[model samples]
Target: MSSAVISISNQKGGTGKTTLTMNLAAGLARRGRTLVVDADPQGSALQWAGLSSDEKPFPVSVIAVADNLGREVGRFAEDYQYVLIDCPPTLETEVTRAAMRIADTVLIPTLPSPVDLWASLRLANAIEEVKLRNPRLAAYILVNQLEPRSALSQGMKQALEEFDIPALNSHLRRRAIYRNAALEGLSVYCMGKRGEPAAAEIDAIIEEVL
Candidate 1:
């Protein structure tokens, strides 16, 4: 099968883009070969990879190119079954656009809040623009950092219905394990008992995407 390039992106910062990118890459790596391309200059994904010893689960490459990110990622498409790109937050950056242009799917991770949902409209617009160049590009919004008991969470889902992009049914609940795992450069999959729920959620996303 050909490689599927999925770009985990959001124009807003602190939207859990990097976190989702890392975990999703890990989840897919367990089933098949996966490569994560860190297109963000912040290097959070790169840092996560650095924490791994000689037995790194998967390889992560940092490629912060503003002009030809699609071309850069394409070079590895033939080798791996999946290529996940961790894109920068700013929509004004060319790298984000380039990544979207080449991505078969773009996963937008947004916090379930009024401010975050409002800020994500710009990214929704950017996706529309990228669709012009990449007619087959499929984009979906993933509700992240969700507080299930909060009224805002329900409201956010209802509000997202009016947006152009569709939000996935599978969501990530607000959990401390996510934070703990990131500190150790490990996915929730490696956290044993505490990470089971988080790992399940990531698995659901992978199942839906594939």
Candidate 2:
């Protein structure tokens, strides 16, 4: 089968989009060939790949093209089992739209906050617009950096119930391990004991999505 293209997108920055993209890519790489396509001009995912160890499992490609990215990425998808695109945090960008045009699934990572929730709705609206071209496109909201004990987390779930897009049952907690692992150009899976939970969460997401 051709690789499934999954786009990690959010209209708001700092929503853990790049973090989710890299970790999810690493998680999926364990089972099969995986490639990450960094569509954001920021090139954060590309920089992460550079910082990664020489033994890193997967390869990342940078594709900043705003037009015809769907066609460009379709060619890359031929060799890998899975392809993930880290999109810029803005729906106004053609790169984001192009990624959505080809993606089988769009994962929107958002913090558990009122602002992030509102932004997710806007992103869902944009995805709906993109669905016009790619009717098979599926989008899911992933609550990231969640503090389970906080009231905000509980409230965020309740608020999401009102939104059109469904939120994933699994969530990623706020943890320093994610940051530490990123700095070392590693995924949570390589963090040993400290990363076990975080790694499991990423694994669950991969399972649920794929």
Candidate 3:
């Protein structure tokens, strides 16, 4: 079977979208071929891959197409077993629409807050609009930066359910390790090669997605 193309997106920024995309791509790469498309103008994911420097951890080829990404994405499908598009924050961008239009699945990452939930709903609507162009697109939300043992996290989970968006049972908790790993141009999947919480979380997300 061909690999699934999943776009990690959100309307509002600073929701750990790039962070999750890179880590998840690395996690899935352990099992099969994976390519990451850095469709965001910020190029954070590409930078995180250490592409800004002369050296990179591995050849994670990232296409720096921010404007006309839809056309570029079609070309990406033939190259890898999985193509994970890390979209720009705003859904208004054509790159975001392109990723949504071709994605086999769209993973929206959101914080556990009312404002974030509202933004997520808007993102879901946008994904639906793109689905009109490609009826096979499947979409869902994954709760990010969740603080375990907190009331806010509990409330947000309930609100997401009420919104009727299917959420992954595995929620990513707020942790500094994620940031630290990014700086090293390494993902938790690689950082935890010796065994760590970050690695375990990444593995869980991969299992859920698969």
Candidate 4:
């Protein structure tokens, strides 16, 4: 199979893009080859990998390339079955466009809120822009930091439906464990194969994206 490149992107900050990217990387890595490219200028994903001067290495390798992701990713894609790009929260950046240009699919993470929904549209438009150049590009929106049964989540879901965007049924719920796991360079799925709420959601994403 040609390596499937999935970019976890959002034009707004704190949308859990990196969280989803990292966890999905871990989940897929267990099954087969996976590589994560941190295309964010902030290097948050790199920091999360916990590479220090003393050790100078990490379980997952992350490179700082906020400018030329397509070139960097092209070089890395030969060795991996899947390449996951953790993008910055800006569409105007070249890295985001480069990622979108090369991606087989783009996973846009949005919170179930009006503000997030608005931001999601902007990201969606950017994806569309990339699609114009690469007509075969596939993209989907995944809800993150969501609270089920709340009026806001319901309203946002309804709003998303009004638009033509395909939103994934599986969502990442608001939980403290997500925060805790990032500190250890681990995904919630690593907590266990059983009784792990996040694993189901991550699996759902894999099913939909694949």
lDDT tens digits by residue: candidate 1, 36-85: 88888888888887776676443444344445776777777788888888
Cα lDDT of model 2 by residue, 1-210, tens digit: 698989898879989998999899888888888888888888888888778766763344444555577787777776888888998888776777788889999998989998788877777778889999899999999999999999999999899999899989998999999999889878898889999999999999998997
List model 4 lDDT by residue over 1-210, tens digit each. 557888888888899999998889877887778888988878888888772343433345566775667777888777888889999998776777788899998888898887788867777777778899977788888889888878998898888887657888888898777787787666776565432888788888888778
The Cα error of candidate 2 at residue 27, in Å, is 0.4
Q: Model 2's lDDT to the true fold?
A: 0.85
The digit string of per-residue lDDT tens for model 3 on 1-210 reads 455888999978999899889888887888877989998889988888764345537436566776666667677666688889998888665777788887888888899887898878877777778878899987878889899888988899779878856888887888888887777877775555442787788788889877
Question: Which should have the higher TM-score, number 2 or number 4?
Answer: 2
Candidate 3 lDDT at 134 equals 93
Off by over 4 Å in 1: 55-67
Q: Judged by lDDT against the true structure, how good is candidate 1?
A: 0.85
Error in Å for residue 33 of model 1: 1.0
TM-score of every candidate relative to the true structure: 0.94, 0.94, 0.91, 0.91
Query: Which candidate, 1 or 3, would have the higher TM-score against the true structure?
Result: 1
Measured with C-alpha atoms, the lDDT of residue 171 in candidate 2 is 88
Model 1 superposed RMSD (Cα): 1.7
Distance from true location, Cα of 169 in model 4, Å: 1.3
